[model samples]
Target: MSGAAALSRPRWSRLLLAGLLVLGLTACASTKGPGSPGQKLDPWESWNRKVFNFNESVDEAVLKPVATAYSEVVPSPVRQGVDNFFGNVGDAWSAVNLFLQGRFKIGVQQTMRFAVNSTLGFAGVLDIASEAGLERHSEDLGKTFGRWGTGTGAYVVWPFFGPSSVRDSFALPFDRLASPALVLEGGNSKAAIIALQTINARANFLRAGEMLDGIALDKYTFIRDAYLTKRRSFEDDDEEDDYEVLTPETPANPQADR
Candidate 1:
């Protein structure tokens, strides 16, 4: 294959994966019928279970060990700073999505939070905004779609990405585009930043994961229900109802931890 063709192949493969995800989720939603209660929301339970197992295998073989090492090697303060930096980046995108959802006041608040953190907090290495009472409003394109009345269709477990509904799966690409790391000039640099972020996030959730493993008999079902519940809370207009989950992509909410 030509050099250009080689480069384009991966891009095409990603697009194909995305296409299959959407189609599969849509089909699952359409195939719904009278059955077990779980089938109502997760019509593709069989397929989702397979993907969930794959994700767990990958996490056990790779992500978990790496995250464990990162947590042990990195000091607490430095890890917190890394979290703050990425959280600040997310705040910018949150503001945009809040505006798109016609939440002008919260959008402005999120914008201020990003501004304060970026400048006063030193490129978001410190969360001065939160200390200053500028609350973090964690909005994303998926939540925006929910706000726009898009139904959360058929829960699905994506390979590597974990739990999501049809609407969220569709919104994933757009949300990913908003990541600051992706805007960097080189693919390798972007990948490195993204990898760092993912590892940092997983490290943060190590305790929670352990707790989950102990308590949940069916880990897949437990995670799926928890994810769907959290996503539903986001769709509710009552901002006070907001909560956080231990997902790799979302920044940890300190208040929720408390």
Candidate 2:
């Protein structure tokens, strides 16, 4: 009976966690601002803002602290490789989009580019994109929707997930459910995957985070704006993502979206 109960326990726990993650993400999304007062908030954007804040709080309280500690313990190169591996995986999405758009040459090239480069080329150390004179682009579901002319619904801060816009907020549930991060079975397997993902995420942003440390007056605002910009850049035009509305220091007009 005890052994049976133990087996059931994990399945139950996984279900509970999955439910909680969805509920939490929904609750977070419902709380975003409408951009400002007097401007009526888009219903969707308002929700996104809430989620975005929730995500940030969770990151600060849990993930960021844990990641910082892990970084201190783990050597940087290992962490970098882990990051490269994940990035390469996400790059597959971009390659697909490019292919669907009839840019088969670019898509096929990127598939081989990210795979061979990240694996055999020492995790993108050789910078194959630069060598081949091709741009290295990021693609994800959120960005794909944006390419279809979707407006960024609202700014949302999710717990532990970081800043997200309205459109991207909607994409989170699907992404999380389909995520490789959740596939581990055994206790040790789960632990190993979590550690690797967390460390890789942190390591991937180590340089950007460090750069922000030097430039930001308010870390929260800085991260929020930077993330929003970067996410949009991934989907839409480069200019849309590059313009920063930081107070006391505004960026110059970005080139028109392509």
Candidate 3:
């Protein structure tokens, strides 16, 4: 085969993959079935189940073991510091999204949290902002879009990323772009940072995963319900009540339908 033809093959494959994702999203949005806690949000359950199984296999074979080893080898303080560092980075992005969502006061609070943590918390190795009564309001572009009246189209699961809605899936690229870790110079450095972040996150969830495994008859359903519930809570307008009212123009409360 010609070199150009060979190169075109990979491009075609990527296009095919993108087409499949778009098709899946369309199906998920249009298909309606009987409503259950899990089924209510997951119209694409069969595909999601297959993806979930794939994720489970990957996790059991790779992530679970690595995370287990990391948790055992690393000290709790060090792990907490790693988490805090990433969270501090996230706060900067969150503040931007909060402002975009027309939440100025909370946005300012998040900005303060990031500044305090980055400096006073020793480059975010400690969470000094929480101690100072500055709450962490984690926001992302997906949540910002939801606040702007974009609907949560459908629940879907990606290969390694796991559970996400159509809206969140679209926002994933922007989220990645917003990540401070990706700003590192070398590819190796970026990969290492991402891997550490992933491992640390998984390690933090180890106990919760074990508890879920022990109690839930259908683990997939339990996780799906829990994820949907949590995402829905983030989109809920009632959460605005938790924040102090800033201004009439920039209302603390966002719209409920997301």
Give the winner by lDDT.
Answer: 1
Runs in model 2 deviating more than 4 A are 1-57, 100-103, 118-135, 177-191, 204-218, 234-258
Which residue pairs collide, candidate 1? none
Q: Each model's TM-score, in the order given?
A: 0.79, 0.59, 0.80
Question: What would you estimate as the lDDT of candidate 3?
Answer: 0.77
Candidate 3's residue-wise lDDT over 112-209, tens digit each? 99999999999889999999999888889877766655545567899999988776787888887765567799898888999998999899999999
Question: In model 1, which runs have C-alpha deviations exceeding 4 angstroms?
Answer: 1-38, 235-258
TM-score ranking, best first: 3, 1, 2
Per-candidate Cα RMSD to the true structure, in Å, reads 9.6, 10.9, 9.2
Better of 1 and 2 by TM-score: 1
Clashes of each: 0, 23, 0
Q: After superposition, how far is residue 21 of candidate 3 from its true place, in Å?
A: 16
Task: For residues 132-151, write the lDDT of model 1, one tens digit per residue.
Answer: 99988898987876665555
lDDT of 3 at 131: 96
